[model samples]
Target: MALSEQGRHALRHPPRWHWLLLLLILPIVAVSLLFEGWTTHEVDGARTRRACTSPIPRSADNGAPVLRVTGAGAETVQMPLRTAALTFDGGPDPVWTPRILDLLRARHAHATFFLYGTQAARHPDLVRRIHDEGHEIGSYTYTGGDLGSASAVRSQLELSLTQTALAGAASVNTRLLRLPHTTTADTMCGGEWSAARRASDDGYLLVAATARSRKPPLGVVRQYSHSALGYQEATKLLDDPEVGRFTTVTSGLGRPSLTAPASLLQRLQGNALIWTQSLGHRFARSMTWALGIAGGLGILRLVLLACLARVHVRRQRRHRSGAPWLREVNDPVTVLVPAHNEEAGVEATLRSLLASTHRDLQIIVIDDGSTDRTAEIARGVGDPRVTVVQQPNSGKPGALGTGLSYARCDIIVMIDADTVFEPDALHRLIQPLADPTIGAVSGNTKVGNRSRLLGRWQHLEYVLGFNLDRRMFEVLECMPTVPGAIGAFRRDALTAIGGISDDTLAEDTDLTMALWRVGRRVVYEERAVAWTEVPSTFSQLWRQRYRWCYGTLQSMWKHRHAVFEVGPAGRFGRRGLTYLALFQIVLPLFAPVVDVFALYGVCFGDTGQAVGVWLAFLAVQLVTAAYALRLDHERLRDLWALPLQLFVYRQLLYLVVIQSVVTALLGTRLKWHRMHRSGTANQHLLREPAPQPSGLASK
Candidate 1:
């Protein structure tokens, strides 16, 4: 099958896996949320407080019972005078570990190195090098999470995974372990004591740091990190004469040690842990990169929208000021209204067209197999200029093609069945056709049924998102879609593109792109305004947007070859298609992940940073939306719905894009979705008189 056919098939019968993929994401998010919440409650909060203020409890003689657990679960161990043990915790760092190792090598000192499984797995060579260099290896746990606060499973996994990494890296496992966040043997208290006892039961020896003093203490196991600062601190101890001998904990204790070879099963488990940890690390890195890309693209789009909107405003002002120099096209025109089960708004649409300021018009309403009285309503208008044509069901594109066939004028204006036009809308819509280079013109479309929150949210989107985007597209000379709600095209342009194609669901977009490919300019005429009723509920809105998004994908794919063409087609293909793919399709797909990351930050990471970034992005949107509303002569109060819209309405739109892309990829075909209209378009227009064009004469 051809690529287009494949796309159609994907839309019609989307593979089950497509939905499964989306469903899978939900469980992942839920798991992440649960994990993050648990971590925050059990570890993160306490950890933060401990970092700010010492968490280790003090005991008499500066020996904390809860800080350390030896083989016998002893709070403190008595060592021979003039002997000191050096221990390093928290890493097998690629950079710092090597430097520390070099320092230790220069001093000919061997210390116990407590390795985090995650870091050890990531830098297994370092782990092996530490062991090979005659240093004692011990477990610092998998993620260096505090075993004191960890669940039983987490504590076991932490220690076992570290052992697994050790066994995989060096084919040997050690009994020595270290409790994370504990400073000295005397510092272990409450939960730390309990955790130490548990490790002792598992046949692991626990090591902790001795208290720091002006004079180095002999026979004390001093812990340090594998970092530059730790190396500096350890240098002081190595240089101290009081610390007579620097050796491993077991050596200092006069215990003979032997490297035990790992069992095959142990090695296998270790390697598996290493693989899983590595995969998690890679996934985290990928998400970080994705977040950056998504954020950058989103910001770039906003900046472009704002800048291009200013350019559009300036250009429009220049045109308005020099209106006398503008050529007025007063040629006879044909208006096509393709209706399908649109009995609710067809009469109002016909009445609005009859009220156009331009005198000459041939209005044709093509009823495409409507089960309602849409045709009857159009014919009942009883106007000479209005003609109703009945046709069998063939979809919007086919009905539009039929209307185009009966068009008698050089210019054809197309409006949706649910749209109500202003008195001067038709006149302003056609004025752009006076330019021979301009093949088609897109008009300003506004949401009519905006009383409810959903409608109000969509209203803001129309003025802020769609209309502002059209202005930018016009300034760039890469207008991708002349909206079906209100657009005008030269009849020659329509004929050149073979009337209207039913190949793609979005006929208007497809035709607009075709016009651009043929080297004809498509411009936006903001003065030509039409009010159209939007979906009233979430479900209805979702279906409408799904069809729109899918249709747009089909159109873009159909014009894929234009990217390699010369001149205008290449420009439109590269600039227009690239913009659409990035800002529309790609960003929306990644937005859910961004939201998930933000939620994670709030739960387990830095809540302030996450909220700050989100607020900054929202601020940029608010400014842009405000400017867009200003340009469209809409009230700023509508922006109150925008923030709330971001939470729910925005997500719904993203889901629509996701579903559409999935459908397109799976080669499922989708039937056209028709909204159930309530004639809200007429109600809105009747609520207030339509604004007339300034300094323009009505025919």
Candidate 2:
């Protein structure tokens, strides 16, 4: 089962996550079918338009009863107004519209076609044909389509009339108009009614579609153009003279007409159909809940995994005192630092690396199109060990690739310009390269400063969530990410994977997975730690984490099939894939919901249900927090923010997942949302912002 080059290329590329989201897709499609089936049933048996507009002939003696409402002083009273004709609103699509017009043409019909301005204009020949066919042409208003302000509404209607005139409407002065979507009965359109009054002054009459259809005394014929195609057959049946009931408008030139409602099963089926009309809404809601619950489960699983990882790491640390995992070695390492708009941070990063005890390293700072003095500041560091390369802003992947091309050393260490490495971090990171079996080593990243509450929370997160759990993956040789901040890879190992693809947002993660796919082992060095700055503001944090989470998803989605291959290497690959899917993919999606849903429960007065679930979720979070603390030696106080993080921090991850999922689905533009640098180059990273004077809102 070996892959050819072409097959490998195809296999190496990750299918869109939507393919996996097919997990939810089947259920969604099923739900849609149920609703659609119900709609088809109701439309087949439901009432059709009972009335329409035709010339009454001003002098003709008509028997139509015109019930009137009049206001009086002593006997003043309010009464319901009756309507004779039903109106169809919004549309002029060619597909079903022509059929409707043809049906009307066959019957020598004259129902007002309330046409959308754009549609009417686009299909003017059809509008001209509608007029040519002797139908009463009406306006659904231009952007009756747009539910906006009074002025906006007027503008929409006026545009519609103008377009209708342009479309060869027999007369733009036609008084008939139907509001978009909602009826005059809905509250949102009361303002529309005022707009309607202004329209009335122009001789306009507001119309509503009252699903009633019947034959008149003089062989009067009418037809409707429904928004959907499925409704066409049903409307035809409803208007059938043989099996259907006849309906008449009270104001029309006819005796008062009353039609019976359809059968009991039809009513039941009708209610279901109406609800089914909102199938998209229902599916969206269901998916939202599924996403929430899935997120909660993902987080919970991450917690357990992190705890287990920490326990394993401690055991390894105690037993392997020979320091075998940290065996120091000398191999000339070329450190690639991709810089973009990093004038504020690049110098410090170079300064930190130059200060490292690892003397055999050559630092290449690739400035990826910085408008700022990023390149100048990088060279300004004045270290012979540092080399500054300039290029257009081709992005990190391109920058890293450029740096790698120039690299001469056997090992390549990719570091972010924003990160500040400790003196020994570089030395310890490459130590694992001494073992021929180890092709790559990933370093732990610590928050440089955590004075702000947000920073502290992120600090806690790195310790508990990533570093602690990465320990287990390291031992399993299934490590999913060799972070861009500090990852050491054998130059040959990297080149063997055909270098990194700039197309992905998370190139580091992509490279790591690629290495594993080629039977190269990646290990994490807990002792090799770099301190990096994180976003301080809520918006900044959201954007940063969103990119990271989404990018990781993209990478995972890209390399999904590698998990659990059969040959020793393939088996290892499969294990890695399973670990990521379970820990990274499923866990993050599920954990937040455990927190959010529990909160929702409390709001609904389900105290018992809320408390039970809340405690269980909190316990998982605490386990993760405790484990992160053990790895990074941060305080337990930071763990208390976990619940609050759910409300504020984790929701952003969901948004990112949703955004990424949509992008994958629709093939949206994928560009890296760069993280902004905060402090002066000479200054250390800022502490997280202080808790609000009033903490409740921040909480």
RMSD to native for every prediction? 4.3, 14.8
- On residues 1-699, what C-alpha lDDT tens digit does candidate 2 reach at each position? 111111112122334565367447555555554333322222211112212233222221122212111111011111122212323455567777776666655544445566665455445567667666655556666534333243554444344443334234232334455555433222213344344445545544444432223232222223344556534643564465543222223224342212122345544443343344355335435654775566466575666577567565665556456775556577788999998998877877888898888888789999899999998998888878889999887878889989999999999999889888877888778888888777899898887657667877787778766786677776666788898888899989988889867646778877887787788888887778787878877788766765676566667666766754544356556776776666555655444434443443454324686577667767877876775665555557777777777676666665556555555545444456787886531254433321211101110
Q: What TM-score does candidate 1 get on C-alpha atoms?
A: 0.88
lDDT for each of the candidates?
Answer: 0.79, 0.60
Write one digit per residue (lDDT tens) for candidate 1, span 309-334: 88877777777677622598899999
RMSD of model 1 against the true structure: 4.3
Clash count, predicted structure 1: 20
Candidate 1: global Cα-lDDT?
0.79
Deviation (Å) of 460 in candidate 2? 2.5
Among all windows of 10 consecutive residues in model 2, the one with the lowest summed lDDT is 69-78
Ten residues in sequence with the least summed lDDT for candidate 1 = 45-54
Candidate 2's displacement at residue 4, Å, is: 19
- What is the lDDT, from 0 to 100, of the residue 537 in candidate 1? 86
Instruction: Score residue 514 of candidate 1 by CA lDDT.
Output: 96
